[model samples]
Target: MKKRLWVIYGMLTLATATWGSAFIAGKFAVQSFEPATVAFLRFFGAAILLFPLMWVMEKDRKKPTLKDHGLFVLLGLTGIALYNICFFLATKHAPVIKSSLFIASNPVLIVLLSGLFLKEKITRNSIIGMAIALTGVVFIITEGHILTLFQYGFEPIDFVLLGAVVSWAIYSVVGKVVLKKFSSVESTTYAVAYGTLFLLPFALAETSWLDVQEASLTTWAAIAHMSIFVTVVSFVMYYNGIKEVGAAKASIFINVMPVSAVIMATIFLGETFTLAHGIGAGFVLTGVYAGTNPNLFKRKLKGNIVKNKTA
Candidate 1:
């Protein structure tokens, strides 16, 4: 049991590293490509790579039922296509930190949504952890700006990030249902491929493909990394981790992203990493750890079991 637990944590660390470097790659992407174009290219690249893998994973399963097929199509559209669209749009419009904070909201959301759809019980510990994490998120972004609360104006791009968060939350939660019908790899592959199909017109409409020839070698390298490492490997690892570790625990790794982003940005983009950021990140991590720990899950289950006995 301890060995399996360590493997899950290792997956979390690796997922964070992949996603963290993506911030640096994205910083490069926007230099030569529009956010839309970058997103379109990444999805297209992932679709091409993942489809064959999907076939291999699905070769043994019988034909999918009508309901399962429908779910797959929905997964493609919501989880794959729309998530990337909103994320890229958000990134283009807002600071990466702000965009990432909104994306980080997904962990708590998984807890909430799990309660709603999966009948998971929410116990005191879960509530406490959720509160801690949400508060930490506020702290990270506001940087003790509690006093200036009323003066804050909403950024349009942040909404895009919010949309991304909601979309991904739906995707992760819905995967539970789809997993009954398909292997993790199969489901991920199909959803991503079909999702790429959802965004095909946008890529085709990108008049800037003509400009692809004029980009610097560095831009090409960054785009390649985004396509392969961030898009393909990251998504595969996430689904596998969710299967091995459970969605509730897997989502905590999302909080670890900003750390990697900071390091990569400092080294590659010359972005500053301040003490305030570190303090805020500490809060975020604390919240994530509390929220995802199996101890919290066990406590919640115990509470529910006791409530049933009392009833």
Candidate 2:
């Protein structure tokens, strides 16, 4: 049992690490292909793999209803298409490390949205954590000069990254509904197919077949990494982790993503880590921990009280 648990943990860790490396891959991919095209290519490749895998794993699952199809469309539009478009556009404009940090604050947004739309109970910890995480995001956006945010305003890339966060949060919230009808693998496969279909016209409008052919090997390699490692492999592993350990525990592994992205950005892309990055990352990670695991502090407090009573 211990060994099996360790294997699940390892899969989650590796999954998040690959997701971190996606920022680097996305940065390279956007340099050659437009954002829509880049997103399309990534999912296009992923859909090819996911369709077959979903068939093999979930073939016996019940089919989707019309309402479920609507939900799948929503998931595709929000999570896969819009999110990736904003993601690649942000990577094109901002430093990958900064972009990763902004994305790291996503859980805060997810918590807030879940409370609002899903009617989930909003705990005090969630409110506090959201504030802290938003503050950290602002600090990073302004490069530690929070005052300048009022004086100047947000950069275009900031909006782009925020859009990515918002879209993904919506996807996650809606996914809670979709998960009732379909397995994670099945839903994801359907969403990817729809997203790729949605992205097709925009990708075609952005570039021709010749441009795709002319893209450099590095660009192709990046797309392939995102498709194979980040999308297919990491997502499957993450869903598996959720299945094994539950969502709250599985989500803790996401903290590894930004750290890994920062490190990989430094090593591979030659991006420098600033003082602002360090402080913002600390705040973001802390807030994420607090928000996602609202019961953790209570558990610790309860344990301490029991111990004191025994003494």
Candidate 3:
């Protein structure tokens, strides 16, 4: 049981890392491909890759119902198609860092959605950890000047970013319930396939998609990375993590994204690591640890009390 939990945590960590890197690769891809085209091709590629694996894994599992298929379609719509549309559109309109900050509301939204829709219990530790983790993210993004958030106020694009937050929350919470009926591979594979179909019209309609054929090799490589690692590998692992741990607990791990992104930038892009990065990373890691292991702080406090008595 302990080993399985560690494996799940490792999977979630890998998923978060890939997703974090997607920000960099996606920025590169969109320089050539249209937003819809990028999303379509990415998920279309993912479906192709995941389908065979899903078929093999699900061979012995129960067959899906018509209703199950319907739910998978809905999952594709909200989680993949709609979420990417809003995400691409939002970042197009807003500054990327500001857009990321707005989208970071997803973890909190997921916790609330899980509580309301899934009847998941919200612990005090989770709430406190969520707040701390968010504070760290804001600190990192704002570069220790968090007041910038208030100065900017809300922009129109903020709503679109919020749509992404809500869309992802719905995906995580609703997908959890769906996982009860289908294996993670089945659920993610069908969702990606249908999401590709949903993205087809939008991709076709974009005149910018013509540029895709003329894209440089680097751009094509970025798209491939997004498709294979970010979409196929990361999302499957994310879904499996959600299945192993409840959505609310798993969702908090999303906070690792900005930290990973910054670290990746330092390693690959020659970006300098700042003091705010250290503090923010500390808070984010500590908060996630507390939130996911709710009893951790309590156990430590008890241990200290025992030590004091012995002293």
Candidate 4:
């Protein structure tokens, strides 16, 4: 049993590395395409690859239903559609690591949101972790700008990344509820399918389809990589790992992604570390640790909120 647990952990860690690099990979692709067009094509590309694969794979599973249609569209819009748009836009302005760290805040946000909705207790550790993580994010965001974010020449493109983080958190929480009715694969497949079609109008209208002849070999390779590895393989591995280990453990693995993003971005995108980055890393890691133990954050918050409610 212990060995199996370790294996699952290994798989999750590897998958996180892959996902972490996804931003860098997209970074490479976005150099040629605008974030919107890039976001649009990524879904279309994934659908072209995975839609057929799903039929071959699912073979006899029951087809999805009407309720599923609604849920799948919502999934597509929130998870794939909006998430990619925000991510591509963000990655363009921010270094891959900073962009990734910003979104990595999701684990902490999930805890707070889940506590509110699911009645999960927030322990002191969780609160401390979240505080530490937020401090890291601010330090990193300011690039250690203690006083003025304005000094950093505030780029709106980065805020798009912030939007992506919130969209994804919502996607994760809501998707979990939808998953109760559909298998993860089913939900994923339909979400991908709907997002592809949903995005098709703008994708075709603006993409300059004739440029297919002019696109360089490198661009083609990136598209293929994004389609197969990032879209298909990563999602499959994540689903597989989640099945093998519980979701909590699976989530912790996601925290590893920022490290990979930072490493890859530094090498690939020429990003660097400042003292602020060091401080930010501490905060982010602290937050991840805080999330691991919820008991500490909850005990304190419970009394305060209860008192506030009664008062």
How would you encode candidate 1's per-residue C-alpha lDDT over 120-170 as one tens digit per residue? Answer: 666555556656665655555565564544454686666678788888888
Stretches > 4 Å off in candidate 1: 55-62, 94-98, 134-137, 142-150, 154-161, 296-311
lDDT of 3 by residue, 110-183 (tens): 99999998998899888888888888888778877777777776777878888888888898988999999888
Which pairs in model 4 have colliding backbones?
A: 122-297, 122-298, 123-295, 123-296, 123-297, 123-298, 124-296, 124-297, 125-296, 125-297
The lDDT of each candidate is 0.73, 0.77, 0.86, 0.66
Alpha carbon lDDT of residue 20, candidate 3?
A: 88
Best by lDDT: 3
Model 4 TM: 0.74
Each model's TM-score? 0.83, 0.78, 0.94, 0.74
lDDT of 4 by residue, 30-108 (tens): 6666666666676678777776777777767676678768877887887788887677666556764456556767666
Candidate 2 lDDT over residue span 145-206, tens digit each: 76653453467788889999888877777776676667878878888889999899989999
The whole-model C-alpha lDDT of candidate 4 against the native structure comes to 0.66
Ranking by lDDT: 3, 2, 1, 4
Clashing pairs in 2: none
- Pairing residues by index, what is the TM-score of model 3? 0.94
Scanning candidate 3 in windows of ten residues, the lowest lDDT window is 207-216
Q: Give the lowest summed-lDDT range of ten residues in model 2.
A: 243-252
Report how far residue 201 has shifted in candidate 3, in Å. 1.2
Ranking 3 against 4 by lDDT, winner: 3
Candidate 4 residue 139 Cα shift, in angstroms, is 5.0
